[model samples]
Target: MFTIRKATVADCDLINRLAQQSFPATYRDILSPEQIDYMMDWMYAPANIRKQMEAEGHVYLLAYNPGEQPVGYVSVQPEGANTFHLQKIYVLPSCQGQHCGRFLFEQAVSYIKSVHPAPCLMELNVNRHNKALHFYEHMGMRKLREGDFPIGNGYYMNDYIMGLDI
Candidate 1:
């Protein structure tokens, strides 16, 4: 069985590896190689991830299998009062199609709701063309905005900001 739990410093390297392996597959067609590299470096570097984990307003969770190998992760940061932004959600490609992504999402939502209460909103930005957008919508997230955000190095992400009120 798969289990979801809070990430720790020891899990950073595994999370970085998972990010490196899973990111290219997910963003290769939607983003340039340069952009992918930049985002991965900016977002998934072990130091950066550790900083987020140690930050006051961020929560990072890891998913593990029966053998306790890390297979997926989700990161959330406070956007404002009563609002949280999903910084990233990634599942190892080998683990896809098994409802692991949905399971992580539901677990993240449950965590946020329990911790934040007050009818907080959970938000995430998805590449407009990513099939995950449909999954998010199907999971009851509504598109709140759509726009292009430059991801540096002359690359931009055409994305939809999706939100779910808990």
Candidate 2:
């Protein structure tokens, strides 16, 4: 079982900590260790998370296990009137098979539908080599496109842009 809650800026540190634990493990094999470290600071820094929440309009949700430990997080951002981007979703390695990822993905859809009840597109860019691509496909998302987008520090994300109309 899991509990999902909306996050405030004060929870940035918690989110960062969760990312520190899960993000590296999620990308350890697919990315270079240097890139993982760069992305951890780039995406999971408390200041960056706060900026995303306050300035960028990204709504974040945190998941907790039955014992009240934070195990995962998801964030969704409105890309356009009819498009929403699943910016991030990660579950702790220890919690992977327990449906926490599915719950977080569903909650993200629920949040999107709550805000834009009309038919809209939900998109997520997952690493082309990441195992979660299969999970996204299992969740009914189809590959819409793929790109190698540059981030910074000579790093690029080669990802599949998957989508589902909800």
Top-scoring candidate (lDDT): 2
How big is the positional error of residue 154 in model 2, measured in Å on the Cα after superposition? Answer: 0.8
lDDT of 2 by residue, 69-97 (tens): 99999999999889999999999999999
Identify the runs in model 2 with alpha carbons over 4 angstroms from their true place. none
lDDT of 1 by residue, 1-166 (tens): 7798887878778789999988888989887788889999877899888777787556888888788878888988888798999888999888899888998899889889888878999999999999899899989999999999987777787999999989
Q: Quick one: RMSD of model 2?
A: 0.6
User: Among all windows of ten consecutive residues in candidate 1, which has the lowest summed lDDT?
Assistant: 49-58
Tell how far residue 3 is off in model 2, in angstroms: 1.1
lDDT of model 1 at position 28? 90
Q: How accurate is candidate 1 locally (lDDT)?
A: 0.87
Per-model tally of clashing residue pairs: 0, 0
Clashing residue pairs found in predicted model 1: none
TM-score per candidate: 0.93, 0.99
Number of residue pairs clashing in candidate 1, backbone atoms closer than 3 angstroms, sequence gap of 3 or more or interchain: 0
